[model samples]
Target: MSGGQTQEQTPEAGTTETTPKRLPAAGRGGGGPHFNVGMPGEKSMNFLPSAKRLLGRLRPYRAHLMGIVTLAVFSVGFSVIGPKILGMATDLIFSGVVGQQLPPGTTLDQAVAQARAAGNDTFADMLASMDVIPGVGIDFTRLAQVLALALVLFVASSLLSWWQGYLLNDVVQRAILRLRADVEEKLHRLPLPYFDKQPRGELLSRVTNDIDNIAQSLQQTLSQLLSSLLTVVGVLTMMFVISPLLAVIALVAVPLSVVVTKQIAKRSQRQFIAQWQHTGALNGQIEEAFTGHELVKVFGRQREIEATFATKNDELFKASFGAQFISGIIMPSMMFIGNLSYVAIAVVGGLRVASGAMSLGDVQAFIQYSRQFTQPLTQVASMANLLQSGVASAERVFAVLDAQEQSPDPAEPARVTNPHGRVEFEQVSFRYEPDKPLIEDLSLVAEPGHTVAIVGPTGAGKTTLVNLVMRFYELDAGRITLDGVDITTMRRDELRGEIGMVLQDTWLFGGTIRDNIAYGDPGASEEEIVAAAKATFVDRFVRSLPDGYDTVIDEEGSNVSAGEKQLITIARAFLSNPSLLILDEATSSVDTRTEVLLQHAMAALRADRTSFVIAHRLSTIRDADLILVMESGRIVEQGTHSELLAAEGAYHRLYHAQFTQPVAEADGGDAESDVVGASAVTGTLRPRSPVG
Candidate 1:
């Protein structure tokens, strides 16, 4: 099962169409801001585990984390005290002005005694020591001292906050760096099926977007969370100290604000998930459309593709707007509740102040503390969504990291001492899924130096056969052997070291031509690289370029023609000099001239080496030692081209379909000569062409 394909169904006409069953949607990895629940095709991950794993990532930075916490404590402590100290100044100014207007018998000390009687002994003691400045009638000396200390505390707090942020960035960056490295390493350990079923954009988003979300959230939200928490605690403590009555009034808003924030955030989680999912889906669509732009234009489906893209984009917009709008309400809602509490505190604190139950300075301090308390409440409420998104992203990253890795190399494994390239698959049985049998009890032998050609239509087991040989997918039963040694007993690396493959899809990295040709054996000398290039006839094309072997191939090998890229890959295989070679439609994309040249090159490369050639062009493999025809993942016919043609089997029809046309001539009219004439007409059998 491929994506979007339904299961087999019986029609009203009573015939069943066997559409293969699809893979389960779970464990197919992608990363973005996603909801933990209530979304189509998204896995609901446990928040606690994801959060625990995220914190585990920070274990290595425990010391730095502790230092940051300590700094946060100091930073908040000084900041919290500044408002209280500033309140003292306000009281000092108020008392000095009021004392001068007092009755003739009242002294400043007596006024302080009266303040002590008013249940504010702290304020009374602070006022008794203040120095009165002449003519000013206020304590400028005490005010200057308090203001100076407040300035120092504020500056110190600001410095510590900056240092904490700096340290946090370093710690967070290191942790995310390790996380990215782990995700990349996990990619290598993942099985081929994981890549086969998942889209590239999806996987890339996991590695990039998901991790980035976690990083951004940690960087911004982590420190702010700590600061907000400390501020809330510290402000609440100061509020109660200023006046327990007003503090009780401020506390009334806490539970109410929390209830409102929780309600909105719960709805926003689903929307966030939908938003990111749609974003990822849109990205995948755009990637496909752009990568296959020529196909879109040639097929005149540009408008159709655009419409599909617009639909996905619209969904993303709606989801994003909903999530942000819902989450956006948190700040203002908390602020509204805080303002209501502020009104209540003001009216109540005024009555208490008029009764001389509280000083002007204490009331001012209480008001500031109330504001400070509600500010963190608003911040925490806003951070709720970011933290949710982070946890969601963390779950995605952990999903990949926790997925089943490929089987490890066995301890003290068997090693192929020397490879002579005799390959065999005996009684092999395998299937991608149990219900869909691909290969069953298959047996085959390729003697040393034999060019065995496998010809099949689409969906034949050609690729799977090669994959089995390479141990990409383990066999369900029986064994594959190289030189009569069961390949599975040997480690995958040691087994693959003796074999080389050229796939239909050629891959070239961003490097010079020489570098790509020498990729199989990176240490190959300049002379060896040159020889391999010449052997595969890639030297002709190299010489045509301005920089010869030094010419750079851009990413995806777009700078080179399809035929040229194929030849370069062949040269890469030639450089490896393996004892066994597998070519799966290696020449499918090449021109007739290049295919002819490649055939000769392959002949040279296959000398004294067992080779498996998967070909659609029957003309190129007419002289193969054996030709196997496959249908529905099983070999239906096997023999030399001439022998199979003489038998008038499946291979015969396929051969004639490609090289021979329907004619009045009977079947017995010179089969060998007719083959040669057909080959000449197709220009596919000629090895020495102009590129030579």
Candidate 2:
């Protein structure tokens, strides 16, 4: 509705091309022409900055985040200590078993010395390290105590981990909630021109899909990352406390795992970027195809649209497959390295136990710690892909949040108090682009309660003239005034509140007929709604339906005819009862009979209100108090219909072109005959009442 073009022709500048071009294969980073609106070009994946900013969103919940971290530490700490306590149980049983083999009342040291004398040094050394008394056999009492302690530790760890997960969920949800609100507010603040440069579907993807992905990634990664990191630290500390030698061996695999994860993540990150980009592009294609489905069928371009969809879908598939395949390599690679470390730890640990350099229970506990250390490392490696994908999505969403917003409303806005609807444009110049000037040095005025009709060929700046008055765009130079006050000084809402517009393109949300009409004046009573509808002829057709005013309009309003939709929109404008009215091809879709009826209705509605009418049909504006003919953004002629006819200028030629009939000369022949000839070709029009 805020486009730079007139109703009938392309704007001189900033014309959008709506043809799809084949993009380069995924990961190649080659951009292509978009189908409807321009797709944002590929950007370099800045992982750290984007990830940091995304996490920064949670700064408001820092206290809850800290609590979650503390819980994770305690949870992992208890779990890490469990294996050591179980190892003490193992020691109790082993000492009892060895003591049972010794003679009654024999000391452990004496037994070890006797075995050493028999040249069994390894067995003796193992015996010397055990805390066994002679004739003792598997002390089940002490073993049960140790087992109970281990069980308590494990259960406590489980409870803490569950509580940590619960808290993390809350923190993540609150952070995402704030983020969603920010994005919604950002969308409304963006200028209309910003939307012109972006496809709706692509923008929707950033707001919906990308943000959803970010939420999921944060939820999954943050909780697991916290627990896994704490587990790694706790397990490593326990491993060293048991056997520093084995801990060093387990850590030998860490650098290798790091290298593997880093290499694979680098490759997968680029693929993820490509994947989401293609996803947005494909969504844009689908949206365009569906929106213009009927038009495509009319033009027989279904096959072309299908082919384009297939191409984009294939690109998304390639990007998705590559990302998954590359990232999938990380888990197995890390596990393989961990297994190598396990083997080395086991071999060295077994030797230490055999030689009694370490107790069998200590060696056993160290092996368990070695496994725990590798497990969290593997988890971290596996989660790298999720983190990469999420960060990619965050960058996309951040782009929207960072987009330049429109100029803010004035701090102290001017109020009209009582609007008269006298509109004036003085020395105004505007262009969609800097080099291509569409409207220049334009000046015009409409007195209060006057109907000013603008007639022009396509691209003649007809629609643009009204757009300026509404301040849909800021002027390059000069100013427009409403009731002698500069429109720029007034808040956009206040200025637009005084005006009602009915464009050629009618938009109706999914709702009942009454609801759609009520959108113009949300507080309007039902009686008022019916009056507006009846005046605009919407009531006549609506009553034909079984449900009448309550009949639901589909999302696309496909149930109604084009003329019916136009009528409903006109009713909406009428209900607003603004001081000023703008009708751009408002009756273009209606039939000749309906147009005649609407013209009369509009004439009555225009009473006591300044109205601007942009019409391509010459007959509709014949009775207008002032008719302006614009060409190439300049006013070529201005006069009443009969006055313009007498001038024999651009309007005279345009009039003849429409009727394709010769008319008597104003000076030489009867003017009444000319009026009759014109009325014969076009339908008769009601005489306009003199402006008060």
Candidate 3:
């Protein structure tokens, strides 16, 4: 059975009180300020550690990563050379235009000296810097070759970039697939108590939303970050080759951009953590509201639920807005810094060009390289937001994977063959919390082929008793044995395989009715399923429907009545044909007539099988071989029905309270007559109608 605490109730002295384990307001794995909603706080994960761990998940894909990096390098190399090649073409055109204007057969030095003597010093200085012949015109052939080389380099760069992106995507997908599988396996390895403390929606978010966020973050940031860093390095190198002075001026923006990005990212990281936290919290609230919507409307708490939802939604909005607003500052800040460096480089490069210290083509190419350098820095800063958000999600997922797992199964498991269904609890001690003892040093025995009925009030540890028998929880002390074999010595699966349970709250997945019934024993044949359904009285109602057993159950099973759902669950248990059966208020949802029919069916099912039946309705257990009345997690009374009633102990009182009531005398009647009437009723007492 799924683990849960019973509803809150004040316990008398010497009685056990089962309540949910409370988490500290800021505890790890506990919800934040809104702990009731199951949200983790901002401190749940460290950014650097989580990011390192996330990257470590890709260690197995080293070869693929190396290939991607090599591709990025080649891609950036080709792209960086394009601007320089285009600049060479510009220089060729300029030299050719100047040489065509020069006189043929006149030395360039003579022309430059004449210009200088004619008071054209600036033009003469520029001419002196040129490598043009006196009578040469524009070289169309060389210009075409340079332009063609630039085009080829750019196309090659684009092809390499596309291939790199494809490889990165493939690597990320495969890594995430392994991560998802690990999470799934980890969930199964965790004990039932682990789930008891976690909210359903919060866990679901960790498995679904957080994982997808991690995948998206990796997909968007990995390739872009690699390419952007490479671009920055390649562009910076080209800038230095073109003009060292301008390259140094462009370097001034690097530190400033890093500072701006770092400051904003630090602030935004907390907000992103809070945002995802509230998202899980809000999802938990929404799940609760929807699951209990019928109860909420019945209790007239729609307004209350709506108010709570709005409050949580507002919290999510605040966190989301803060996160986006903070991270959003990175782009414009980096851009502003880059623009400053651009202006400074442009001014310095223009002066060098005018003084003939650098050619006009080199100045233009340097300007282009400076732009390329800053653009990549801006991209890297922008990717910081995604990287931070992804790391936050990765931390959440890692928490689950790191959770304490249930004790391992025995290496050499004890096998039970031809099981006799003899279950014994010897000196068993257990409690959900250390300070609160529910069951201690308890011992009980159920002989093979006997029906044992356990009766108790709310929070009396009745279900806990059955849970221990199933080994859903480990014992704190002592041991339980099945067929003379210590249950802990056997594998949990092999132990549970011998027992079948029919819980009060039935569960049905989205599938055909036949499939849900066959879930008990997947290998069951069609005839076997029909036989089990018929024995449980499920076939009668199912046959009345148009599709009979083929009818599809919706996710919520809304089309099926509560009684029908219970019947389906009962049929499932019956189909398992186990040596032991546990019926936990199995007939609580059926009509009195159906209850009578189910009782007969269960009696047959229980025949020759060791069955543990937990019920509050006394009438259902009257025919059991042994009836145990439990109080405060101890057996207060145990005997046959008649024997317990004759003893007039706790069991007798419970029976009288349920079966006998005071009779009201008519108006003007004597008090003695009322007393006599009430006595007579007690003598001829009858059980109340069973609850449906």
For every model shown, what is its TM-score relative to the native structure?
0.87, 0.90, 0.91
Candidate 3 yields a Cα-based lDDT of 0.82
Candidates in order: C-alpha RMSD to true structure: 7.8, 7.5, 6.0
* lDDT (C-alpha) at residue 233 in model 1: 90
At residue 655, give the lDDT of candidate 1.
Answer: 67
- For lDDT, the strongest prediction is 2
Cα displacement (Å) at residue 651, model 1: 0.5
**Which sections of candidate 2 miss by over 4 Å?**
1-37, 661-692
Residues 1-692, candidate 1: write the lDDT tens digits.
11101111101121122211221231221111111111225555466777788978999998999999999999999999999999889877876775555445656577677777888776555456454322244678988998899999999999999999999999999999999999999998886655554445556677788889999989989899899999999999998888888988999999999899989988888877776667656655666567566666887988988887788789889988998899898988998998999999889887776666777778888888888899988999999778778887787777789877878988878866767799888999987666667788899999989999988765567767877888877888989999988888888888888989987667789999999998989999999999999988899889999999899999867789888888898999999999999887788768888788778878888889999888766777888999999887788999998899999988887767556632312353345444454554464352343764
* TM-score-sorted candidate list, best first: 3, 2, 1
lDDT of each: 0.77, 0.83, 0.82
- For candidate 3, write residues 529-574 as lDDT tens digits: 9999999999999999999999999988999998999999999999
Error of 1 at 52 (Å): 2.7
Who is ahead in lDDT, 2 or 3?
A: 2
